[model samples]
Target: MPELPEVETIARGLAPVLRGRRVEAVWGSGLPLHLNRPVDLRALRAVAVGRTIRRVHRRGKYLLIEVEEAGAGIVVHLGMTGRLRVQPAEAPRAPHTHVVFTLDGGGELRFADARRFGWVAAGTPLAALAVLAALGPDPLSDLDAPRLRDLLAASRAPVKAFLLDQRRVAGLGNIYVAEALFRARIHPATPARRAASRAPALLDAIRAVLEGGIARRGTTLRDYVDADGNSGDNARALLVYGRQGGPCRRCGALIRRRVDGGRATFFCPKCQRR
Candidate 1:
């Protein structure tokens, strides 16, 4: 799944190309694509065609393209193997191309998902979009030590699981959470409240890793790319997420991996003692 940084990268890359550009047409594959609800081609054309794209931005892991009229917009979630890119209107569609938004001049913004897990939703009063409305505060913008402390203190789940809960702190996924915990020296299995005393450090670590990811564009182990079809550089800079059995950069302790809630978590046992 594309996390905050990846989603933000796509939004930033698309904003200039899409802003002020009118959607001239909307096309779908006719194959089943997750619509979030039952939004069909007619519904998409009604909200999108002829409306100028006001802006492109990200909320949690959702990408939003707001239109100029009635606070209406389109929302996209890149489930696992999804990609969004802009290319010449005449360019050949990629293998799984599911939705194409033809811009007024020459290009098209395309959404392709090999796995069909991603979704698209078009609606009015953007606030009425249930998925986006239910997301918690974006960690980069709204989270701080005190706020993180309160959230953690309320959960008995493992610290890793607590942070992974989108309803508690939006945009964190398994990859970033592992790196953040390693940086904060908090064990993934530590009870959330038990880790609350280190909330300041944990919050700083979370922000540091997330900011670093955005600065590097994002971590692309696979399938993730910015709107320009470029892979992220941050994967090479990862500290712990996929370095199982490798020596820890800080203490030379062997890096380790474990599965928590079916997600791979990497850490240094010596550094991240419970």
Candidate 2:
């Protein structure tokens, strides 16, 4: 899944290109797309066609495009394998391109998902959407050590699982969580409450890794890419997410991988002792 940094990067790449551009037409593949509600092609056209895009921003992992009309907006969630790009109308459409919004100036904003797990929701009052309503505070803008401490202290689940819960702290996925835990020197299996006392360190690590990811354009181990169809360069800078059996940079111990809740977590046993 494209996490916070990936979504934010896409939003940044899209803002300049989309702002002030009117949506001249809207087209869909007729194939069903996962929607926050039962929004059909007509509803999408009602909200998007002819409206100028006023802003493009990200909340958690969702990209929000606010339009000129009051209370109207478009929200997109780029699920695993999903990609959003802007190209000339004459450009060849990538395989699986599901939604296309023709802009006034010969440009088109396209959403393509090979696995069909992504969603597109359009209408008024974007906050009313279930997906956006269900998200917690964005870690980058709203989280702090004390706030994270209180959140962690209330959970009995493993710290990794707790962090992965979008309701508790939005925009984190397996990769960043593992990297954050390793940076904080907290074992993946440690109970959330037991990790509370180290929240300051953990919070710092989280911010560091997230900022680093944004700086590098996000980690692209596979399908993730910015709006320009460029792969992120952060993969090689990862500390422990996918380096199983590799030597730990902090300690000479070999890195390890363990699966819990069907997600793989990487850590250094010596550096991340419970």
Candidate 3:
């Protein structure tokens, strides 16, 4: 799944191309792909067409394009194996391109999902969107140490799970959580309450990892690409997420792997202590 950084990358890349551009036409696959709770693709056509995109924004892992015409916005969630692209209107249409937004000029914004797990929907005012409304504070925003400290002090779940919770720290997923934990030298399995003392370092680590991921265009281990159809470079720069059994980049100790909250977690056992 595309986490905060990948989603942010797509939003940043799409903003200039989409802003002020009118949606000349709307296209759908005629099949549902879980848009806002398994809605039909036809449902999107009515709301998406005839709307002008004003801005692209990211909330948690969801992408929202403000529709200035109708005071509504479109929300996109790139589930596992999903990609979004902005291409010429006459570009060769690729298979699995489930949704296409023909812009007012000469290009189209496309949403492709090989695994059919991604979803899209229209939201009125965006703030009223249920999914976006439910998300907690964006980590890239005003999520500071004091606020994060309180959140950690109240949770008993494993630190990794707590970090993954959208209600706690929006935008963190398995990949960034593992990397952040490794950077903070906090074990993934440490109880959140017990991890409070490390909250400052953990918060800094989270910011560092996310900023690094965005700067590198995100980690493209699989179906992630920006609006320009470019793969991410952050994977090569990853310190821990997928380096199980490899030497830690920081300490030269053998990296370890475990499953936390049903997701693979990597760390240097010598560095990350419970």
Candidate 4:
């Protein structure tokens, strides 16, 4: 799944290519991809056709493409597994391209998802508030240590569960959460409040890990790529994620893997003290 960094990279890439371009047409071939939104395929074309692309932004994993006309924005979510690609005008459309945006400038924006889990919606203000209103603060935004501490302290779930809760903290996935907790030296099985005293450090580590991933354009694990179809560089910089059976950078401990919430979590058991 493309987490915060990957989504941000996609938004940044799309911003340059999509700005100033008029929506010549908007149409899709798949069943309703948007979560709980109306699936009328033709409605996309009716409202979005004359509008100009204004800007592209991201909140959590959702990408918002603002347009001039009201209720005609494009909202994308790369669900458990989804990808967006900017393809050449003549390139053959791949299978699973549920949605395609024909640009006035002679190119196409394609939304292809093998899992059919990705989503697309059209609305002004992008319906961002309604879509992401339940999400917690972005770890890379104004969210700070004290606020994180309060949220964690208020939860009795396992720290990993708390970390994975999108309503408690936005933009963190299994990979980043495992990496951050490992860096903070907290066991994944630790209760949320067990690390209450170390919340500041944990928060800092979370920020550092996420920022590092963003700087590297996100980690490319299972088919995650930027809009330009480039692999992320952060996979090389990861300390714990996907490093199962590998040595830890901090203490030379063997990185261990375990299933948590049905997802793989990698950690340096020796370094991540319980």
Model 2 lDDT tens row, 18-132? 9999999989887766643333778778999989999999988899999999868899888888899999999999998988999998999999999878978785888888878
**Model 4 lDDT vs. the true structure?**
0.82
The digit string of per-residue lDDT tens for model 3 on 92-201 reads: 98788888888888898888888788887877666887667777788888688888889899998999899988988899988899889988999989999999887789
lDDT of 2 at 123: 52
Error of 1 at 94 (Å): 0.8
Candidate 3 clashing pairs?
none
Q: lDDT per prediction?
A: 0.89, 0.90, 0.85, 0.82
**What is the TM-score of each predicted model, taking all chains together?**
0.96, 0.96, 0.95, 0.92
TM-score of 1: 0.96
**Which candidate wins on lDDT?**
2
lDDT of model 3 at position 226: 86
C-alpha lDDT of candidate 1 relative to the true structure: 0.89
lDDT, residue 115, model 4: 71
Query: What does candidate 1's lDDT look like per residue over 117-143, in tens digits?
Result: 887878686779887777878888988
Q: Count the backbone clashes (under 3 Å) in each candidate.
A: 0, 0, 0, 1
- In candidate 4, position 29 carries an lDDT of 77
lDDT of 3 at 195: 90
Q: In model 4, which regions exceed 4 Å deviation? A: 32-43, 70-72, 127-129
Ten contiguous residues with the weakest lDDT in model 3: 34-43
Q: How far off is residue 103 in model 3, in Å?
A: 1.4
Pairwise lDDT winner, candidates 2 and 3: 2
